[model samples]
Target: MKVLLKWLQDFVDIEDNPAQIAEKLTMVGLETEEVIYTKELFKNVVVGKILKIENHPSSDKLKICEVSVGTDTVKIVCGAPNVEENRYVVVALPGAELQGNKIEKVNIRGVESCGMLCSEKDLGLAVHSEGIILLENSYTLGKPIYEEVYKDLDDVLFVINITPNRGDCLSHLGIARELSAVFGKSLKKIISKGPKLIGQTKEFKVIIEDPNLCRRYTGKLVKNVVIKPSPDYIKVRLSLCGMRPINNIVDITNYVMLGYGQPLHAFDYDLITNNTIIVRKAKKNERMVTLDGKERVLDEKDLVIADTDRIIALAGVMGGANSEVNANTKNILIESAFFDPVSVRKTAKKLGLSSEASYRFERGVDIENTPIACEIAGNMMQNFADGQAVCGVLDTYPLPYEERIIKFRPSKCEGYLGTKLPAEEMEKRLENLKFGITKKRFEWDI
Candidate 1:
């Protein structure tokens, strides 16, 4: 799992550098495999505004742009059709390096070009881009791109070696929880005060066949969604965290999954047959095409999420292509569920398919995070995709999660660790970890 330092700071207030935090995490058993400094990729890149544009003396397509970088002004030769005076843009100065190509003062069409203007593709922020990246007037003129314009890029990435047993640490929220416990800080909560729902949602229904295989399923209907590229902040964070930003709906789901440690799926509501979602065992020889465009043969032991006519998703592994969100999709059904790890692991291994969602499912995700994740996704969908939430959530929680209580004796724990610690100290530590404690005569129920 790759944990961004800035993202971690959102949950816990820490003043330590990357190396210091890495050492602390390593000491606490969340082994930090590698620490990467991301600002190196964005070094020397600053925001600049075009002062003026003049026709090049030697070329028809080339134009000379006088750009102001706060303290200095430099002339750059650009050939983009969108270049105009007073437009804020990304500037890669002469000493900067972008995508391994170093920028240097060069002569273009007999004019000395001091630096290069950058596009989204040039900065590794997007797969394709047509013109230079434009900045809003809110950005400071001479600020480094990593410092303000794209702060997510000016970060340290920690490659953590998470054990299979620690499935709780697979996401940013989980890691933040751990750090908060370790540092004795409070974990900041994410609140989603979304758009008001009209009434009880009648658009879709959920049915779970076996409560043993699936613990809980929660869904929200978002309507009138516009499919487009996500905002710069969302896309940049996704890219930095190793997820390709797709359309707005899909990216929102992926972002919430990474943030909450809960896997989520968005299905095209218009494609769901009979407006029903049935979670049950797969029939023998059942075949379906997944989102990756590959047909897979299923067995009776495999768990599946089906509509009235056919399977729409492979339960916790992957979604079917038939219900995928597309450019024309207007409404979406966002799914958040907790599937049994054994069932998900078996199916994913047999099908030779693995995804970011499946990886968390196979190890085990938080059952209590189902509705919270749906709420977060819905809030983001409204904020990013121009989507509206249909009043109520469709939830079928056959087996509700129950908190586990363990009897803990402070004396026994101290003896096991060979440390002399007071019972008050032990309670303080457990409280920091968010463990509920019930005081007893000689022992505690945690």
Candidate 2:
């Protein structure tokens, strides 16, 4: 799991430098792959403005562009579909080096290009680059694009190799909690939005028939949501975390999932017939097309999130296309739930559909965060997506989570570790991690 240092700050005040912080994280079992300084990769790359665009006489998919490259205007050939006049983009000068590829002046299809117009892939900003990289209008034509993208001036991208057992560290908040435990720092918790949600009026019902497969299911309804691109902050966080910015409504679900270690799904409320949410095992030969546009065949063992008519989502895996949120979607149902890790893993493996949601579910999500995550996403839409969160959540947790109690003998700390530690020091670490301490005659029960 790649944790952005700035994003981690929202949960804890981590003052340590990246290397020191990385060493501490590695000591705690979350191995550090490497610390990525996103800005240091590209050399001689700067913001450029497209002065003019003309169709190439020889190639239909190509175009010739006059770009303003800070100190000078240069002619370049490009084929990006979104390339247009007066748009700012990343330009790699003749001496620029990108991904070990030495960018030099070259003639393409008879046009002598002085520089290369960059894309997300060309700049190593994203996994796949579609069109040219579009810069915001706020970016100055002469300024370096890296300075704006990595706007904290400097960001520490800690790429940690999270083991499967550490699903709790899958999110920034989870890692912050771990860091708080290791460093004995206070975990900065974000205050709940606490919006005035209307009570459940039998308008929405979430029935969990197969509680063994699904531990808990919670959902919130938000109406009049306008689907649009998320703000720059959300886009940058998601982009840096390796997610393409889709829209505000969808982005909120993704954001909170990263903030908390819980995944939330959005459904087009209008398509949910009879206004119901059903958590049950799939019927024999159940077929549905997921958001990926691929048709998947399900069986009786697969858990599903269904409405009055048909399956709306393959629970804990992906949402169905028929009930997906889109531009015309005005009302949405936000879903946050805890699925049986084994069931989710089996279903995901059968369908060959592995996603971030499935990854977390297959490990485990704190069941207590179900409704909390839903409420967070709902309130975020009201603030960022121009929507009103319909009060109350339709929560159906058939099998509640049982609280765990562990016995710890701080006096024997030296036996577990090579170093001797005092009981007060050990208790402080647990207290900082929010573990409840009950004093016993001999040891502490937490």
Candidate 3:
């Protein structure tokens, strides 16, 4: 699991250097594999403003343009369809190295181009971009692209080696919680207030047919959404953390999963039949197409989220393509549910459709986080996708987890760690991890 340093700082006061923090975390069993300094990746790349643009004389597909690199205006050859004048773009000067590919001045179709205009893909800022990315006017010309585009690029990526049992550390918030205990810092909580719905009405009905497999399921209907590209900040963080941003709705779900350690799924509401969601075992010979465009045959052992007509998603795994959120999708059904870890793992492994959501589901999400995750996604749907969140959530938690209090002895702490830990110290550690501690005569109820 990769943890971004800046994201960590959002939760704790990380005054120690990344290497020091990594060392501390490693000693505590959260081993850090690598601490990458992102700023050192780019060199000799500057923000350039396009001075003029015209068709290349030698080739119809190519265009010749003059760009100001803050110091000098150089003629360059470009071919991006969105290349426009007065827009600031990343320009690779001669002798620049982009992902080990040497960029040098060369002539393209008789045009003497001094440098190359770059896209987000060229800068390694995104998986793919349609054309050259236009920078905001705040970016000054003749400045290094690294300095302007990545103003807060002083980021450190902490590649943590998470054990299979430590599924909670798979997210940024989980790691931050750990750091809060280690560093005595407060874990920042994400507070998303409920939105005033459109007439406080919804259109979907959810039923949990098999509560044994699905512990908790929270679904919400967000209507009139515009699926578009996510903001640059979201895209940049996702790209740096090894996620390919697809669209606003999907990206928001991915973001929440990364931040909260809770996996979320979004479905096109209009595609669901009878406006209903059912969580149950798949019927025999039932087949559903995933977002990857492949048909996956399901077995009776596999749990699935289905509408009245057909399966909409493999429960805790991949969503069906017919119900996937896309550009044309105007309404969405956001799902945040906790599935049985064993059942989810079996289904994901059997179908060969492992996703980030499946990975967390197979491990297990915090059972209490289902509704919180739903609200977070619903808020994002409103903020980023221009959607109106329905007033209430469709929570189908037929069997909520009943808390069982466990007894703990302070002497066991010293015996297990082979250290002289006082009773107060043991209480502090348990309290930091959010265990509810109730004191009796000489024992603690946890």
Candidate 4:
């Protein structure tokens, strides 16, 4: 699991350096497999804005442009299809080095080129066809693009090797809780309680035919949503966290999952057949094409969410393209549920579809935190996407899992550590890790 430092800050406040934290986390059970320093990848790239663009005197495909790189304006020769005047872009100045390759002044077709403009492909970011990404106008001109794009560029990414028993550490919040225990601090959670509903949600129906596969399924309908690209800040955060922003609704779900470790799915309400949701085992020859446009055949052991006509989503794995939120969608159904770990794993493996949500569900999550996470997603959708909750929730939970209780003995802990810990010290550490005490026993309600 790759863990970024910025994501870690959401749970606990650690003043230690990256190396120190990595060393500490390694010494404990969670071993750090690798440490990636992304800032060093782009050393001397800076932000620049196009001041003027003119047709090349000699070549029909080439263009002459004047770009401002903070201190002064320089004339550059370019042939990109999307070069426009007065657009902010990334500029790699002369004498600058990227990925150890030194950029130098050059002459192109009798035109003196002092610097070169960059694209996502040129910067080795990713494979893309969009003419150099038009940066936000708010970014200051001539500022180092790497620094502006990654405020915490020096942050370290720790690839943690987690064991099957350590499912709780799969999420940012879960890692935070472990860090709090190791550092003797309290972990905070960004949890919301309730949201406003503009209409009654009872207009739709929710049915769970197989309680063994789905433990609990909760859904809320939101109306009048605007589907647009996410803001720059949101896009940057998602990029840094290794996700590409899709749209407002999808981005909100990704943000909530990264923040709280709970997976959420948004479905277009109008596209749902018969305005009903059915959670049950897949039919003998059920088939669906996921959002990624890959067709998958399902077995009887697989679990799926079906409308009256066809299967709309692979439960706990991915949603179908037919019910996906689109630009014309005015209403959405936000799904937050707990699927049996065994069922999710079996289905995902059978369909050859293992997503971030399925990976977490297969391991296990804090089942009790489902409602709080749903509320967080709902609030973000309403505030960021201009969406409104339009109904009561549709919750179907036939059976709830019992909370886990662990018993700890002070002498046993000290003996296991091969050191004698004071009784007060043991109690303090356990309390700091969010364990409640009753009589001489402590329990963790996971």
Indicate which candidate wins on lDDT: 1
lDDT, residue 365, candidate 3: 84
Cα lDDT tens digits, model 3, 1-446, are 98898888876777898888999889878999998987666667888899899888778888888898887899999889998888888888887877677888797877788888888777666667788878777588878765768665557888999988889999988898888878767666666464232212347777888788987878788889997888877776777788887778888999898988998998888889988888989989999998899999888999999999899899888889989876689998888888999998998888777888888887778988778878888988899988998777766677878899999988876789898988987787777777899998868899
Candidate 1, position 412, lDDT: 93
lDDT of 1: 0.87
For all predicted structures, in order, the TM-scores are 0.87, 0.90, 0.93, 0.87
lDDT of 2 by residue, 1-446 (tens): 87899999999988888898999999989899899875555557888899999999899999999999778899999988999788888898888887679989999999999888898667544445679877766467767666765464246788999998888889998899988888778987565454333325465877889788887778888989898767767776776677766788888898898889899999999999999888888889989999999998989999999998899999899999999998899998898888899998999998889999999999899888888888888888999989988878777767878888998777676687989888888888889878999989888889
lDDT of 3 at 140: 81
Model 4, range 1-446, lDDT digits (tens) per residue?
76778778877998778787888888778898888876655565778889999888888988888998888898888888888888888887887765456777888888888877887556544334467667765688878776775465446677789888887777778777778877887887565345332222555778899888887887877888998766655555565567766788988888777777788899999999899999988888778999999988887888899988999999999999999888799888888888889999988887778898998899887766666677777777788889897545566667877766766666677779999888778677778778776644443232
Q: Give the candidate order by descending lDDT.
A: 1, 2, 3, 4
* Inter-residue clash pairs, candidate 2: 197-391, 198-391
Candidate 1 C-alpha lDDT tens digits along 159-264: 9999999999999888888888777788876664533322135788888899999988888999999998888778877877888777788888988888889999
Off by over 4 Å in 4: 57-61, 71-82, 93-140, 146-154, 192-200, 391-393, 441-446
